[model samples]
Target: MVRRRLVGAVRSVFNDTARGERPVQPSDEALFAPDTPIRLVHADVTAMMVGGVAALLMQALHPRALQGVLDHSNFREDMLGRLRRTARFIAVTTYAHRDEAEAAIARVDAIHARVTGTMPDGSRYAAQEPGTLAWVHIAESWCFMEAHLRYVRPDMSPADQDRYFAQSGLVARKLGADPVPDTRSEALALIARYRPDLRGSPDARETARIVLAGTSRKPAERALHRLLGEAAVDLLPGFARKMLGLRRPLLTSLPTRAATGMLANTMRWAFGR
Candidate 1:
């Protein structure tokens, strides 16, 4: 049930973008800058917002879904291996720009702190409070989803705009909240009511794949791979085909092992495993 809604939300965001509606962030210019670096940054933001919320909701609602997805014997191991590969790829690509990644991480940490009312090294208070956790998760998801629909969608049609808003309202209703407004200022106002701490933070755009992978159950991981493929074709042109084709086999061979390793390492660090 939640999975289907999640998939629907993903499709709606993409479709909203394709229709040129202000579904996510309300500024198309920010999302489609002509410069390659800027474009990459924009893509990163879109992926982060869309994938982050999706991953969080999935984790909160279906904590065991990832295990189910990975139950295909060798499948899980192969995914884990692929992640390690992808991490290496990110390192190679952004090694020279470590500062940028770190800055982004800092921004995310700050936002997380503000929303959860605890610093990185602080106690996991939110984890213990179900109400706080659910509220934060839903708020984050709504913010990210709204940003994507506004800025990233390609077309500017009335139907698309209506659909985008409708979907946003549906999500809000699902969480027992009122719908967000169509304007950026109004949307921010809504976010502020729930996450007053994050009202003024500069928005950061971490890569979707990386952020989602950090969470326990990420519905968008596989979907993101597919999206990346589409993005490579439409935006990068031939990049995905050449690189992903070569990387796929290695990735496929060790999913479970890699995911388990990551999960184990995280647990060990966070809770002595």
Candidate 2:
């Protein structure tokens, strides 16, 4: 009974019961094959949450992407809601039937079509822009892999890692991301190419704060959220941390990593993974 309740609570956090999202059962016709790296990596709830936060920070560093969020999304007010929607998207795309995954992609594409706006510097920005979408995809895939490696599979093979990128690239292509990276080297090179376009605007920093601070009212939940946020920040590249004016987890790195690993293990156990 206790284990069942714990599982239900975790699922509720990720599944958004109010919106009719439940756990996605992996389908024989899912986008990726069963036991694939993408499936294994994305299965750990704790790692994905940490990685998702890190990815959001990385994505906000791009002025156009930040502008889109500021002008269109209620990220400031409904951060958890936004995160749940993203989690749902990943679950659907990764584990649902191919038709459902394609429909999910179509829904995102339609939303992107409407997410255009002008940046603060009088430049037009569209969420559907292929280059911008590529950055988003790269940041998310890289961070997710980083978190998975750190918390779940430190020795995941190079071939499997490459396969993960290749698998995720299919979704990126469907979403109109140009030049999606299908290997670790390609992802690094793509990030390098976009370095000049990244920035730490005021809006981005504020959003980062909101994301890391989290919205949990319960003290225990808040403490766990802080631990996850710190771990996520520690996973970022030094350049990204510097641009965002976020400090490295220097004195607390060991404890933070240890605590996060424990939490990851506990979550995995709770979910019977």
Candidate 3:
């Protein structure tokens, strides 16, 4: 009965929005918006959550997944090749902001150096050197979007989303990278240029659809319940309560020590800690 009601509510919300009516404001909206410093912080939090969950799941199921995904033997060479290709794309599109673009490229170089503890083989990595300024302008802009979208309103009108994407592509091209692709792979590839070592087999086009869908329609609370069913609740009652508190905070609280223990228990349940 509860699930049915929740589904009905979600459908009603979407129907209203689709018909140009104002949907009910979620209680959390005031706390989460596109243009706040808190949004950036939230994005960072979400990234950490995604990374941590991925690591935990992979470790539990197959410890070798990491090694297989990041096969070190050809990793550097492959990454350098991709970077060079990306640099060419940036050169043509980001010409107007050449200096800023090159700085973005340098940032990627620095990230590479930190990751590998050595510079990529210059001879192996060499492509026609594009203007440094252009490279920075492109790479940094891409980084900004990657970091920004995770926390900000990932849902915008289709027209606005397209405009924002185009502006990002322009930044990339000005830095000497090729024109950005309208497809999901193109966006993922752009990100890969900076962090080639990170590998996930997520389909770019599917991801784009998910992002758009997530933004376009009202999110179904039933989906949340499905993800956190009775098994999840029984496993860590305290943490489960806190999650519930997110929707009804006035009804839940714990002593500091108990809250700490609940969090620890939740992580342990999640990671076998």
Candidate 4:
């Protein structure tokens, strides 16, 4: 019963029932073949939860992405809502059947179609922009796979890694991103190419700050949230961390990473999946 409660609580973070909404029941379980690597990788609760944080940290580095959030969303109050929607989208696209996936993708695209704004520098920003979409997609895929490798399955084969990236591109393209990278190295290189365009700003820094702070909860759950934040910070690229003034101590870096890994395991045990 304790394990079940722990699992329920973990699931509740992604589930909307706590907010008086129903859990997202699978529309169809035929999205991927039962044996697909993508299914296996994403099914790990620890990696998905940790990597989701890391991906958000990386995404906050992109100026327009951060600006879009500031200009468009009531992010502070509805933070969990935002996370639940993203998780729901990923779950549907990755595990639901083709029709459900397409519907989810189309719903997101329709929402994106309506989000438009001008940045502080008087540059136009649109949620539908291919570049922005690609950044979000790649950041998510990169962090997710990284967490999977680090905490869940260190020995994941290179071929499977490539397959995961290439396979993830399908969802990216469906979301209207052009030039989605279909290989591991290419995805990293694509992020590199965008370095000149990525910048640290007040908005970006604040986004990172709020995301890391997490929500109020009981002692054990609050501790889990704190550990996830530290793990996310650990997973961030060195320059990215510096950009947001999130520099960790050099002496404690090794121990911190080890602790974060252990916490991830504990989270998974609590998840009981």
Candidate 3 regions exceeding 4 Å error are: 1-143, 182-185, 189-273
> If candidate 2 were superposed on the true structure by all CA atoms, what would the RMSD be?
0.9
Error of 2 at 152 (Å): 0.7
Local distance difference test values of all predictions, in order? 0.35, 0.91, 0.33, 0.82
lDDT ranking from best candidate downward: 2, 4, 1, 3
lDDT of 1 by residue, 1-273 (tens): 654564455434333345453323213332122333222322343433333333332222221222222232232235444333323322222332434444544443343343333333354332223344334444444434433443343343545444433433432333334444444345445444543222111111112233233432466666654443332222211221232222334444355334433432332344221
What's the lDDT of the predicted structure labeled candidate 3? Answer: 0.33
What TM-score against the true fold does each predicted structure earn?
Answer: 0.26, 0.98, 0.25, 0.92
Candidate No. with top lDDT: 2
Which predicted model would earn the best TM-score?
Answer: 2
Return the candidate ranking by TM-score, descending: 2, 4, 1, 3
* lDDT of candidate 4 over 11-42, digit per residue (tens): 78777885675554544455666657777788
Q: Which clashing pairs does model 2 show?
A: none
TM-score for candidate 4: 0.92
Q: Which run of 10 residues does model 1 get worst, by summed lDDT? A: 199-208
Cα-based lDDT at residue 11, candidate 1:
39
